[model samples]
Target: MSKVLIIFIKNPVAGKVKTRLAATVGDTTAVEVYKNLLHHTQNITHLMAADKFLFYADFLQREDEWPNEQFIKHLQKGNDLGKRMHHALEQVFLNKYKNVLIIGSDCFELTAAIIEEAYLVLEDKNIVIGPAKNDGCYLLGMKNPQPCLFKNVSWSTSQVLQQTISICTREHLNDCLLPTLTDIDDENDLSVEQKIYFKLKKSAQ
Candidate 1:
């Protein structure tokens, strides 16, 4: 069975994306930053994975803007963050892939090796989580579709990782955790990590 990778991204429209960061960096800058993040994510995924898809917030009107012609681009359809992710995974599993890995664009430390490691862990574990320093997760992978792992959980909060762990425990699922990494979400979160933020800014430019 083929391994699949689903990249989750929002429309990088000014004043619509990254609202928290827009409060400090302005809408225009936030949009530009989000675009750069998408570019970086696409680059890394293209280099590492063979089967990839873009789980976009909005449907793409122009095909030229998207990278791979083989990539299956689909609009996310769900009420909340958790539901959207769950729905995306369900779709991927329905495609007959053996393992599916989903990642967000905010994480700078995410690399091809990290993704490959997650795929490797799926052989023995039911779920593999790449935890973020902010107590969230950058990546989530599973061998099968399991919506219970995402049900009724608080998203975009510091307790996100903990809540996911609780869900896994309750379901008796075997889970593997990777080393913690940082993700750029808000101004305060960036302030403490000036070096990484500036590095990303420079790379974006």
Candidate 2:
């Protein structure tokens, strides 16, 4: 029974990674913030007992903190967010991973425990989603590949979580919901106790 974790991320370029955050803080600050998020995610996921795959949003980084021995890197395919996610999961399922989980690099509250829990929930539930406190979701997992959950849903909108739930209900898929967590999308999201932390830290640096 092979389990796999797929991480979706963009290259941590100055003006590319977190556009909304960049809008609030300058581009350099946004880059620094994104790098911190990446480092945090990498540290947590590195300890998980599963095959890890890093799907870059655009190009692949051959020389980075993600040591080549630990992660199998690839470029993300498809035309939109939904299709790209579906494709990544689909490829892993095709590669024979029974338990598959996919996550983005935006959620500050994501922990190794939550990821481990997702793997466990997939033991019975057909799907598990870690909903963001805002309009989107942070993590999505499946016992087996079900690309239907990624379809017919709006991307980058406040209604994403609701729309995904509707699709799950319509498809009759048994879904488990994890505790909602804060995802860093805009200034308002960081204001949840993290704005001060990030700002002060940036000031010192």
Candidate 3:
């Protein structure tokens, strides 16, 4: 029952985070939006019943919103998204964590209940995926370190989820799919509430 949740977040820099969304909203506003998503993620995960690991895409922030007491922070070590996720999972698995899950800060639709469902699914299945629109995924969880899942796969494309599923099928892994969720990557992906919130944040700034 030793489970670990690996949350991948970028440093809240104006031009570095949420670049895709920034294309339309501008960098400062995109940073504001990403910060909101980070706070939402923190609120949902802080009370979960698992050891939380916060993987920073850039440098680690020891005095930021993610409290040191709650999140074990680490710097991401790979050049690509797939490799970084693989490295994080490998690190946690090496520590003998029975269940390991990875998530990013882009999914506003992701909630603690969905995370709990992924862990519950993993109790019976080898892999669990929370599929996102356009062939991405909001979450990926597994009981063991499966390097093949990350090998030769296209990262950040419309084929990601399908390619991973194909890998699972080829490996004969028992996999489960949770409800589909959306990762807020583009301007069109924003909800009404998020849009209003962003405007208010911009006005306040």
Best TM-score goes to which candidate? 3
Give per-residue CA lDDT, model 1, range 1-205, as digits (tens).
3899888988888988879988877776677767877877877787665588788887664464566475678888888889899888888788788788999998767888899999999999999999999999999999898889888688989999999999999999999999898787876655446546655765677
How many backbone clashes does every candidate have?
0, 0, 0
Q: How close is candidate 3 to the true structure, as a TM-score?
A: 0.97
lDDT of 2 by residue, 145-197 (tens): 78777777888888899998898899898999999998887777775456777
For model 2, name the residue pairs that clash: none
lDDT rank order: 3, 2, 1
What local lDDT score does residue 17 receive in model 2, on the 0 to 100 scale?
77
Q: Scored by Cα lDDT, where does model 1 land?
A: 0.83
Q: lDDT of candidate 2?
A: 0.88
Winning candidate number (lDDT): 3
Per-model TM values vs. the true structure: 0.89, 0.94, 0.97
Weakest 10 consecutive residues of candidate 2 by summed lDDT: 188-197
Given candidate 2, what's the lDDT at residue 15?
Answer: 83
